[model samples]
Target: MILLRLTWLSLLNRKATLLLILASISISVFLLLAVDMVRHQVKDSFSSTVSGTDLVVGARSGQINLLLYSVFRIGNATNNISWQSYQEISKHPKVDWSIPLSLGDSHKGYRVLGTSQTYFTHYRYGKKQNLDFAKGKPFAGLFDVVLGAEVAKALNYKLGDSIVIAHGMGNAALVEHGDKPFVVSGILKPTGTPVDRTLHVSLEAIEAIHVDWKAGTKIPGLNISAEQALGMDLKPKQITAFMLGLKSRLSVFHLQRSINNYRSEPLQAILPGLALQELWQMFSLAEKALMFVSALVALSSFIGLLALMLTSLNERRREMAILRSVGARPMHILLLLVIESSLLTCLSVLFGVALLYLSLGTLSPWIQSEWGFRLIVQPLTLWQWQLLGILMLAGSCVGVIPGIRAYKQSLIDGMAIRL
Candidate 1:
C-alpha cells in the first residue's frame, strides 16, 4: 500500500510527462482496435448483402463475375438467358420464388434495374430483412419507377418526380430515353448495400424503352410515342440474370446441377454463401496488412513510453537517495516502476475504448452510406481481450529497463544527494 501511494505521488508530480505518455498509448490502442473492429464489420456487411436466396442463375460465365454483376450490380453480362427458359425454371416444383433482373440502363451514374413487383415483395438482404419503403408504394404503371434511398437523396427526388434513363451503364451514355420519362413512385429505405444505388422498374418498361433501338442505337426516323410503345407487347425476350429461393434447402444442389446441365441455354448457378466465402479469401491479404500496421503502431507507442521513463530517471537521483535513506530496498523501487507502467496502460486502454465508441456513434451512418458497411458497436471480442492482455504484459516488460537502472543507481547513491 505504501509503495502504491508513493508511486501515485510521483506520477502526480510529473503530470505533464505522464499525460503525454497516456496520449501516445491511447492513440495507438485506438488505431489497433479500430482496424480490427472495422475489418470484421465490413466483412459481415458484405456477406449479409444477399441472403435467403439459394442460388444466383445467370448466363455461362465465371462464378465471381456472375455473383458480382447479379448481386452487387457490378460489370455487365456476357449474354442473357431467354425469358422462356426463365419461366420454365421458375415453375420448378422445388423453386419457391424467383426474381428476374434486366440491367443495361443508367440514370446519371446509378445502375437502373428492370425487375417486377416481386422484387419489392420477395427480395431480401442482411439476415432476411425485407425491403421497406420510406415513402409511397411500389410502381403501379409502366412509366412508374421506384428509387433506392441513396438515389432519392443524392438527386433530391420526391414522389411523382420525372427522370429519364440513359442507354448505357456509366456516366457517359450513347443515347438517352428522354422521350419516355419515369415517375418516382416509391423510395426504398436505406439498405447499406448495392440496392441503395439502384433504380427499380418493371420489365415491360425496359422493353418499351428499347422498342425503337437496334444493337443499342436508335433507328433513324423511327419515332414511337410512349403511349404507342405501351400498347405494343412488352414481354421481355431475355434477361441478364435471376435469383432463386428453394422450397427445401436439400434441393439446392439438385437445382444447381440441373441449371448447369440445361439443354436450352448455357447457364451457371452459384451458391451465394460459397461464392461469398471465395470472395473473402481473395481479400485476406489486405486484412493481414492492416493488422501488421496496427502492431507496429503499438510497438512505437511502447518505445516512446520507455524513452519518457528513462529521461525522468535522470532527474530523480535525489529522489532515489530519499528512498534509500528511508530503508527502501532496490527491488521495491523496481516493482514500483513496473506497477506504475501497468496502471498507465490500463488507464490508456479505457480512454481509447471511450473514444472509439464516441467516434462510432457519430460516424456510423456516414460510413454505411459511403462504404456500405454497417458497424455495430459492441463489447470487445475474445481475440481483442487476448490482445489487450498481451499489450499489458509487453508494457510491463518494457518498464523493467528503467526499473533496473533505478535499482542500480539507488545502491550506489544510498543516503547521498547527487545534485
Candidate 2:
C-alpha cells in the first residue's frame, strides 16, 4: 500500500508527463478498438444485406460479381437472364418464392429497381425483417414508385410527388424519361443496406419507360406516349437477376446445378450463404492490414512510454536515494514502476472505451444516411475482451525494460549516498 501511494505521488509530481503518456496510450487504444469493432460490424452488415434468400440467379458471371451487383448495387451486370428462364426456374418444384430484379435505370444517382409486389412480401434483410413503410403503401399502379429512405431524403420526395427516371445508371444521365413521370407511392424505413439507396417500381414500368429508347438513346421521331406504352405489351423480356427461396434446403445444390447446366442461355445460380462467405474471405486481407497498422500505432505509443520513464529516471536519482534512506529496496522501485505502468494502461483502456461510445453515438445516424452502414453501439465482445487482456499484458511487458533500469539506478544511487 505504501509503495502504491509512493508511485501515485511520483506520477502526480510529473502530472504533465503522466497526462501526455495517458493521452498517447488512450488514442492508440481507441484506434485499435475502433478498427476492430468497425471491421466486425461491417462484415455483419454485409452478411445481413439480404437474408432469408437461398440463391441468387443471374446471367453467367463470377459469384462475387453477381452478389455485388445484385445485392450491393455496386456494379452493373454483364448480361441479363431472359424472362422465360426466370419463369421456368421460379416454377421449379423446390422453389418456394422468387423475386425478379430489373436494373439499368437510375433516379438522381440512386439505382432504380424493377420488381413485383412480391418483393415487399418476401424480401428480407437484417434477419428475417420485412420491408416497412415510413409513409404510404407499396406501388399499386404501373407508374407508382417506392423510395428508399436515403433516396427519399436526398431528393426531398414525399408520397404523391412526381419523379422522373433516367435511362442510364448514374447521376450524369443523358436521356431521361421526362415524358412519363412516376408518382412516389411510399417511402421505406432505413435498412442499412443497398435497398436503402434504391427506388422500387413495377417491372412493367421499366419496360414502358424504355419503349421509345433503343441503343441507349431515344428512337428518332419514335415517340410513345405513357398512356400508349402502358396499354402495349409491357412484359419484361429480360431481367438483371432474381433471388429465390427454396422449399427444401437439401435441394439447393441440385437446383443450382440444374440452373447452371440449363440448355438455354448461359446462367449461374449461387448460394447466398456461400457467396457471402467468399466475399468475407476476399475482405479478410484488408481487415488484417488495418489491424496491423493499428497494432503498430499501439507499439509506438508503448515505446514512447518506455522512453519517457527511462529519461525521467536520471532526474529522479535523488528521489531514489531518499527512498533507500527510508529502507526501500531495489525490488520495491521495480514493483512501483510496474504498478504505475499498469495503472496508466488500464486507465487508457477505460478512456478509449468512453471515446468510442461518444464517437459511435454521434456518427451512427450520419453514417447510415451516407453509407448505409449501421454502427451499433454495444458492449465489447469476447474477442475484444481478450484483446484488452493482451493489451494490458503487453503494456506490462513494456514496463519491464524501464523497471530494470530504474532498479539498477536505485542501487547505484543508494550506495553512493551511504558512502
CA RMSD (A), model 2? 1.9
- How well is each residue in 46-109 modelled by candidate 2, as lDDT tens digits? 9888999999999898999999999999898999899999999999999999999998889877
lDDT of 1 by residue, 1-419 (tens): 99889988998999998898899898888888989999888878778788899999999998988998999888999999999999999999999999999999999988999999888878989989999999999999999999989889988999989999999888863578999999999999998888989999999999999999988899999999899997999999999999999999999999999999999989999998998888888989988998999899989999999998899887988887788888888888898888888888988888888888888998987886666566888989999888888888988988799999988887777778554
lDDT of model 1 at residue 83? 98
Each model's lDDT:
0.90, 0.90
After superposing candidate 2, which stretches have Cα over 4 Å from the reference?
415-419
The top-ranked prediction according to TM-score is 2
Task: Please give the lDDT score at residue 81 for candidate 2.
Answer: 91
